[model samples]
Target: MRLETRDLAWSDTWRAARLLAHAYRDGTIWAAAGTVAGWRKQASLTLLYLAELLICRWEKGFALGAVRGDRLDGVMISYEHGERPTPWWGWLLRSFSCLFAGPVAVARCVRISNDLERLKPTEPHVWYAVLGRRDDSPGVGYALLRAGQARADALGLPGYLETSAGEEQVRINELLGWTLRDEYVLRTGAVVRTMWRDCPVKVAS
Candidate 1:
């Protein structure tokens, strides 16, 4: 199937989030809330809310998708540092939406997010909040990575991401010149690897 990377619109929030939920169903970070009953359902709802906030409300955020016809094969939600601020209501919206995901899920997700944030580099760089592709969308991950790296390259900034998608992903990032910064084992014994790519590499689109 032919695939093209393009900015996803707010209307695609549910679709995109559902795709992510399926791909990252067993991911390290989101699975922190697994102790909760119906954890997968809670996680899906949480992703819906988070996707809404990022795709529609967050000023610094943007989402890219690998698409074919009407379906999304892959997605990368990202944002730049020190660029634009998230509106105050954005957090309120998330807090309110978390009600559906339950307090326990919200709390664990918050903790994981905070820990990952603290572990990341404090430099100005593009943050890939999440990246995933369907099994059928072969090589979609690399295409999205190239597009993301190109954006950082154009901005004269670096690229940053945390992944628990296992060794294959680590190798993919390394192949693209992204350096593994560090790996932190979460409370659940899940290992999250933080990676960084130096800015301004020439990319042939």
Candidate 2:
């Protein structure tokens, strides 16, 4: 059955977080923050996903979910450039939730977010922040990505994202029309690739 994709309701936060945690648990890029924060496997990812979802929601970032019957099959979290300005207090409130992981976690998260933002292209574009799906859902991730691409196309801007999801994911993004822009290797030996896809539906000049 084809899963439906739409904006996930905040009411479904727990379920959505759990699905994201499970989907990216084995991914090295996904586990980096937790490693620095001292969170173990499942617990770390679950908390990370929860923190991200909450922060993204509070900051007006986009959350697209793929659903099958009663559960979410995948999620694509993104942020469009200059969508809505996030207030200072709003950031504090959203970030406070991550304290459950400890102060180190929070500090590292801040550093990482700042580092990635610095690396992003200055051109106006959509940031494909987080993309993951259930292990059994073969195409849910790509489907949600295509949806993101469509949004970028409508905006007449490119889409940009960084991935530490490994080389396999790099290849997949290439197939989806994302070109490798740069790469950074972390101290923990993880490689994060910065990628960009030109407007997917450009009109002929």
Candidate 3:
């Protein structure tokens, strides 16, 4: 399968959102709270992702896509040191947008955010906010990971990401050189793992 990586355009936001909604439909923290199914839930998830895309764009962060031919099969959203911890207004907007998923889902999302914050790295790093691949796509996830890591290396910054995908993602991160920093159980009972990857130290010849 031919895979091409590029910066995601504003026009591609909805398409990427749909891909993430379906890709995480059964396994993400959203799914654990029943917010990954149904039309309302899907719509809310799409809006949430769209908000994230816009936030990343505003921060001059990376919102990348891995396309297989004309289809966007994978997405990776990340922000460098000074760009993360999205501003208050962004969170407020995200929470408001998620209202359509119902109170329970919104509350769970908030709690998950809190949990992630508690586990975040104390030092400056690139935050990999979201990484996902289409259901039928294979290997694209790793490609997306590499794309984010490449940016982190270029900036000479460590990388951080929290995953609710459990062991599978943990193993992938490990294979990609990330170390497990911590794991916590969210209020919704989903276990999230935070991983870290130090930047490659350049050595003198």
Candidate 4:
């Protein structure tokens, strides 16, 4: 089987959002009602946020595969750069949101953000990937990971990510040579595990 990958465009935003919403709904559901509620509350925009995370932060690559010149089989969104860390406006936002969104929501974001800060930062040329497929498209996840891996190799750096504590994704990360680096228990009690793979080593092989 053959697949093609492309850089993500603004036009792909909506579709990417749908996939992200699906991915995070269960993954992030355990968070307090406020944070999770906003995400659950605005499913469409939440999807949009996922796409924005890729496009706005990471030097990105996106792909959509087609089969037999017809059906859209899968989609992958990825990034390969360190984020220019911004001011902690998210904290401020949550503070205000608590006023209207209530205590649980505010507490949720606070817990989640604090949890994420535990990971060690990476250097330039790193890449990260998230993939989703039409139920019929097999091997899409691996294909996406490989594509991101290839990008990191070309750039000569490692890639990092935090995986939800799910068996399938964990197995995939292991197969792709990613090692667990850290784990954070968010306010919602779901464990998010950080992992990394050395791109240069993989690329040199």
Candidate 5:
């Protein structure tokens, strides 16, 4: 299906969140937290994703959407250099809120958050933070990735992303020219791989 890309609108937030929640429902750290939390899983994750979308918007980051004739089939959220970090109060609030997801889940969240912080690149770069697509959507995920990477290239910034060490994910990153920079295992025992892609350089003819 022909997919068109555009900046995600305010009206797309909730729907985007729902799609993300489902997309990550079985594999991500947040999904692991939800699994431990049991009944509060859905609420906790939905809220977390909602918060992320808000932060992405506030940071003036790239929140791109892949739409098929008005239906948002895929979404990607990324932050360029110079964007403000998530406020202390926002982190506090999110932490406190995760308490309802139970102690184990909370601890997992803290550990994963810390690990991500420690792994973040110090140089100016673009962070490819979140990407999601509906189950029925095909090629939309790749479209989102290409769009985000093009923006990063335009800004003359390298791109960074972390994903599960699954074979498919690793293959996809390789296909997109992202190099495997590092690999680590989370406290939850999930293996994660950090990938980097250098910005395309223009040589004067």
Candidate 6:
């Protein structure tokens, strides 16, 4: 497939939401590890689908992408800037998140969110990347990673992403020289692993 990567605009949000939903479904075991057994029904799934948009896309310094020759076949979303000393805003958001998603759900989300933040390097220019790949192909995933990494390098920083579900993705990260930083077992027995990777090239002067 002749694929091209571009920065997402407003028109892409709706389609990107759909793509994210599909990605979540395709990786359901990964997305809802602890809650899947309880919230496998339509309502829970719907709420969760919305949750992705509310938390992941709504954050600042986020990038969303649709990979295709002309239209979007797959989508990638990421955030670059985040708190280093302390995520005070993140803590506040989690408090609000508990109201919408409930306390237990909020706890799980906080754990996952914190892991993503910690995976980011301490370098001044580093930005955390939260990536979801639906098509399940290294070609597609790597393309997204490359595009995001290029943007990060352009800004004179490193990029980071977390992969918890698929072994194929773990291999891909290894190929790209991503290091495993941390792992945690969710209440649902899903094991999540955090991964980090520095940009392959230096930023242009």
Candidate 3 regions off by >4 Å? 34-37, 85-96, 187-189, 202-205
Give the TM-score of each candidate.
Answer: 0.83, 0.81, 0.89, 0.68, 0.88, 0.67
Residue 39 lDDT in candidate 1: 61
- Which stretches of model 1 miss by more than 4 angstroms? 37-57, 82-85, 201-205
Q: Per-residue error at 41 for model 4, in Å?
A: 2.9
- Give the poorly placed runs of model 4, Cα more than 4 Å off: 1-3, 29-76, 84-103, 125-130, 133-138, 187-189, 201-205
Q: Residue-wise lDDT of candidate 6 within 1-205, one digit each (tens)?
A: 6777777666665666555555665353434434433333233433444444445545655555646665775556555554333245544543443454455655666676666555555655444434555574446667777777677777666656656656777787788667777776655666667776665565233
Question: What lDDT score belongs to each candidate, Candidate 1 first?
Answer: 0.74, 0.75, 0.80, 0.57, 0.79, 0.57
After superposition, which runs of candidate 6 have C-alpha atoms over 4 Å from their true positions? 26-64, 83-107, 114-122, 125-128, 134-138, 200-205
- The better-scoring model by lDDT among 2 and 5 is 5
Sort all candidates by TM-score, best to worst: 3, 5, 1, 2, 4, 6
For candidate 5, the lDDT comes to 0.79
For each of the candidates, give the backbone clash count: 0, 0, 0, 2, 0, 0
Model 3, 143: alpha-carbon shift in Å?
0.3
**Ranking under lDDT, best-scoring first?**
3, 5, 2, 1, 4, 6
Across 1-205, the per-residue lDDT of candidate 2 in tens digits comes to 6688888789877778788877776665444555533244456567667767776788877889888887789998888873435566545645544555456655666777677767888878888888888888888977899888887788787889888877887889899999998887664678888998988566443
Worst 10 residues of 1 by lDDT: 49-58
lDDT of 1 by residue, 81-179 (tens): 624354666666566557666778778888887787688777788888778788778889889989988877878778888888789989989989888
In candidate 3, what residue range of length 10 has the lowest lDDT sum? 28-37
lDDT of 5 by residue, 64-170 (tens): 98998888898888999724479665576466458657888788778876777688788888898888898898778789999998898888888889888387878
User: Per-residue alpha-carbon lDDT of model 4 for 32-120, expressed as tens digits?
Assistant: 44344554444533534453444443333434332324334455554556453333553343344345545665466556756675564
Worst 10 residues of 6 by lDDT: 36-45
Q: For model 2, which pairs clash?
A: none
Question: Candidate 3's residue-wise lDDT over 1-205, tens digit each?
Answer: 5899888878898898888766766655775565444777777777778788878888889999999778899998898893565778788768756777888877776787776787787788899988889878888878988988888888888899888777887898899999998888765677888888988853221
Candidate topping lDDT: 3
Segments of candidate 2 deviating more than 4 angstroms: 29-31, 34-51, 54-60, 82-90, 93-97
